[model samples]
Target: MTAADLALLDEEVTHCRACPRLVEWRERVAREKRAAFRDQTYWGRPVPGFGPADARILILGLAPAAHGANRTGRMFTGDRSGEVLYAALYRAGLATRPVSVSADDDLRLIGTRITAPVKCAPPANKPEPAERDNCAHWLRRELRDLAELKVVVTLGAFAWAAWWMALEPVYGVRPPTPRPRFGHGVVHQMPGLPAVLGSYHVSQQNTFTGRLTPAMLDDVFRQARSLAGEESRG
Candidate 1:
């Protein structure tokens, strides 16, 4: 039943046109192909969460990259940000491969699933609050479907806030009054809900600038595995 529910929810995510601005941005990016990928076809729709249905760790990010996920139809694929993330996941023994060039690649997340607060690629990589709110139901549904979800490692503050919002509406988990702010390596444990961890995003700004090192990223996943009670194979 849970598998069927998650499959259907993922299917529903691709057809969502709830936000006009997001729709325009994602579609336009798809239509206007980048020179490097001009020979390739773009996915240009709401990206869906993907991984083992019973995954215990959820890696939540802000949104899809305009050329990355918007082009590959898979979360965190075909981009540098994804390169950093997938490599780290592989080193952590959570992913089958260390690279994700396209959705059809031989990449697999072992016990972790990846998602975003906003499904669509927004203009300038920023989704308006209304667009985020409009897209919240997809997350709400995904969270409800991840029956074994135990820990969430949020890539940035947006994902951090989104998970907090999902707690009450999706899981009936009311976070303590005055919600906690996001900070890398910080873990938030609350009653009757999965633990949440914050991490700096794996964008070039963080990676190339040395703000988030490979060791730092590995530590975050190590912490996530520890929190989820999973044995480390990395």
Candidate 2:
């Protein structure tokens, strides 16, 4: 609920070694070092959510990319996925810059936060269900701490499901029977909780294949702003 509390949680997330598999993978990648980034030091630890604690919108992703966030120590940064995502956020007036290149970059999110269900980057970009479960507590605590949260923009089916799962424990209410299906532009509202909006992840698979476009992503955030009662630009 407090800024200091969120900061403490973030620090705890970075030091976590809860799942052995994830711990090994993230560190291995950091030590091996990608060819292009060999000279740069890799974070090789859990990437905590970015943005202010009082943010009204939360953008949830699947997980960090081994060569992206795992290298930069910031969610959705240093990767093609971030390129697409941040650009769209800029178009929606939610981001101060359209590119997120490094953890120290001046880029900033306006009234929004970006995080992932799994804090560590898994091998092959796929995390086991056990790993996801192990990291669920972090997400739950983040949700409970974002006191002004009004909407969640889930970037894929995994994030959509994670949002639902994390909310029940925080709100002490179960999701409605027959949970809503996930798809681009889908919106579902739960009583006394922030509205959830679905969007195709900005991964290369989606953006390169035309499954997700800038305009589509822009519209999603536009809707999010409206849902949160924030002003929107054309």
Candidate 3:
């Protein structure tokens, strides 16, 4: 990502007040845990895109974690979910590092970027339909800005639905009779973007219980890499 792109994203995230409920919840978390993340400014407002702006693969996640991205300002940082996702990305040769703790940490995405459907940490981590719709414009703009984007990796069913809805119009495809169901490692191709891969979200439940193993996640990335015409080191 260019410096300009990063700056713009930062500015938007800092000033984002799209959902008043989210703002209130994040502020409460920030105030309650002030001592925990004193040095790291709580970006409790809204999270933004992270990793390379020129990324060819966009990783779509559901939302920021209350104690994770909400506390650390960077998406997927300071969270178990991010740890699992980053490890898989590193193994697949998509990431320069294995962990994402903070924005200042040295990490890079060669052919990938990670974003969320709802940028803010919602109450109970659930964003209502109106909130998701409100944030769709930003996601659309991000996709539009990535000139080299060829693939999108959606983490969960919600993310998959949002992405599919957002891109269907751009691709001019007739909506599916019964919308495709989400499954781990399922791949779908659209007219505009050749590949859209779906995977179970790397939440604590999946990772801790071995539902989504590292090797399994790596295999998904390997497929994504192949579809994107990128070499997979894993």
For each of the candidates, give the backbone clash count: 0, 0, 1
lDDT string, candidate 3, 74-161, tens digits = 8898889999999899988888899999878888887888999888898887998998988887787677667778788899899999
The positional error of residue 191 in candidate 2, measured at the CA in angstroms, is: 2.2
- Report each candidate's C-alpha RMSD, comma-separated, in the order given: 1.2, 1.2, 2.4
- Alpha-carbon RMSD, candidate 1: 1.2
Q: Write the per-residue lDDT of candidate 1 for residues 20-127, one digit (tens) a residue.
A: 989998999999979999989999999999887889999999899999999999999999999999999999989999999989887889889999999999988899
User: Against the unseen true structure, what C-alpha lDDT does each candidate score?
Assistant: 0.92, 0.93, 0.82
Least well predicted 10-residue stretch by lDDT in candidate 1: 225-234
Q: Pairs clashing in candidate 3?
A: 1-53
Candidate 2, residues 192-227: lDDT per residue as tens digits? 889999999899999999999888888998899999
